[model samples]
Target: MTIPKELEKILEITKEQNTWRRKETLNLIASENVMSPVAESVYMSDYMSRYAEGKPYKRFYQGTKYVDEIETLTMDLMNQVTSSKFCDMRPISGTVANAAVFRVLANPGDKALIAPVQAGAHVSHTRFGTLGALGIEHIELPFDKENINVDVDKSIKMIEEVKPKFVVMGGSLYLFPHPAKELSPHIHAVGAKLVYDAAHVYGLIAGKAWSNPLDDGADFLNVSTHKTFPGPQGGAIFSNNEDYYKPVSRTIFPWFVSNHHLHRLPATAVTALEMREFGEEYASQIVRNAKKLAESLASLGFKVVGEHLGYTKSHQVAVDVRPQGGGAKAAKTLEEANIIVNKNLLPYDGPEAVSNPSGLRIGVQEMTRFGMKEGEMEEIASLFKKVLIDGKEPSQIKREVMEMRKGYLSVKYTFQDGEWEQKFSSKVIPMII
Candidate 1:
């Protein structure tokens, strides 16, 4: 049978995106990452078509024995990686993980404390998103803009005054670690649970490139498996306290998830095993590249944030791009040059600045996974200067970007070396019958 024209066009577009994103471009998006070839291969398994509604070895459906074993292995690996006593691999996304916890811990009309949006709280933690959906009232934690963290003393006072049911730490725009150790006692004294949203930095934590919230007094750690973790896209909930395990697990199913995405189990297991072996090295390089990139950008006259704190301690680096036509315009320009980045809200920006905010949030994890290091970070910063500061045409800079990308195509920190090219080559090209 002949392939339909529209279907062929779809295949053509997929091919273009795969080539452009995976091969030709420098992906610097903080919330994005590439799965290793082995993980990706397992991600495309027959498990995608099946469902296992409950915990391992116990399910609402049949033919889930293998699924049970795989999930159990995945859970064990997750616990080993995070050093937590309990883990739930069921939440489909980080937001779903947050929702599950919220439903389990708080009732409607309960007050919750969260880092302010400007300070990096994800929307899911706000009253406008998941928290609001659960009918929880969320108050912003006091932020110390100069220090770029939660104002510990002020937040403690607010916690006592409001007595929220939960206090959420960690965020999407995070640059430094929150004061989890400092606030945990105060939060618990007020009968509030400490929830750390490690969605953006869980991989960094696993790699030992960042602090583990579970070790720092967080009662619950919620995370997305992708991003800096370099795994399949999914979410996991972890806690050192086993007392809260049953309630959290029960809430994940029958309330938030049913099938729970079986395909990601083996892929997640592969990633966990990879992290156990290579996470430290990968994470160390990621932070070094981020700091080097920030310094290079700052030297080139870009307004890199956190200058007072030595730029950054994680894979993320934010730049105030208002000088170069604001973040939205600058991000679009960089995208045209094949240097992918995202517009972001800075601490000084108003809530309304989200659409065309003052900053660009760049992460080196994906590029670091592609084997680009500190020197490559310098090259990337130079490219940014050319397009944004020197007023060069994006098309002109795109040639250099592609040339720079050519040498860094292979993914590192995984079992298979140079296997992504072989695995994806045929899939990207349209199949003609």
Candidate 2:
């Protein structure tokens, strides 16, 4: 049988991306990660073709006997990793999780305080994103330029003055730990809830490198599975405040999510278990690699942000690429060289500068999972220098990029060759043909 032209094109494009991205290029995208082989194996199960509209063991649909068990197990693993009493994995993305929590805590006309953009507030926390859509007024807390973070004292004052229903913390372009411990009390003092979006640093928290927001007095902690955590793409919300559970869980169902994407449960469970065993080692190396990459880039004369504060404590490095023709140009150049990074807004830039922002945000998590360390970070820095600084032709530099990517193809810090295939997936997942 002959394939249609459009279908053949789609298949060819898929093959090209698999070769080019998975096998050849260096991926530095901060908000992304790859799952391990075992996790991927389980993720391709029959769950994709099914639905379980409600909580495990309490489904709205039939044929959900196995769904209840897997979803329950997945929730248990999530609770263990995050050290929270209540967790819901119904939201399909971090933004949706944020939306459900935001709606549950604050009414449509209510006011909410958030860390300012420069201090690393994710878009979901801003008036331009979810909050705006919900009709809640989003206010930015004070930022301390000297510390490169939220101004705790000033923000406390703002919390009192604004009387916001909730306070939002965390970021898409994060570096150091936020003042969650310091701000959570003040937020509560004003009868406000503290919501921490730990999407970018869930693995670090599980590994015990970063403080868990719930322990720091945050009422709720929200996360996505595929950032530094290296799971399938999915979201979850965790909280120690049991009072908020029923309402928030209901909001997640009827308000924000429906079927809940059943396939994510198994894959997420595998990743959670991986973090339980190897999170500390994996998270620690991520920070080390990030710092090394920052130091290396700075040595090559790139203006790495937070230099005086030791670059970064997480798996991220922010660079001011203005001198190298700003972030958009620099990122495009590096992509041409098979090196990936994203254009990002810096503290000094206004919202108008988003299209041609002044900085580049880089994450070391994926490469860290691929087993690259300090020495490899230095090598990567040289590749950046060759493409962005020394003015080398990108096609020539891509050859070197592909060479470096060769040895690091195997994923680390996981049950890479586990028995999930023989024990479960073989029985559960059909061949799909």
TM-score of each: 0.96, 0.97
lDDT of 1 by residue, 1-433 (tens): 9989999999999999999999889999999999987787778877888989988887888898899899999999999989888999999999999999988889999999998886799999998899999999999999998988899999999999999999999999988888999999999998889999999999889989888998888999999999999998999999988877689998888899989888899889989999999999998999899999999999999999999999888889999999999999999999999999999999999988989999999999999999998899999999999999999999999999999889988788887744645665455322224
lDDT values, one for every candidate: 0.91, 0.91
lDDT of 1: 0.91
- Across 19-51, the per-residue lDDT of candidate 2 in tens digits comes to 888889999999899999878878887899898
Model 1, which residues run further than 4 Å from truth? 417-433
User: Residue 53 lDDT in model 2?
Assistant: 89
Model 2 lDDT-worst window of ten: 424-433
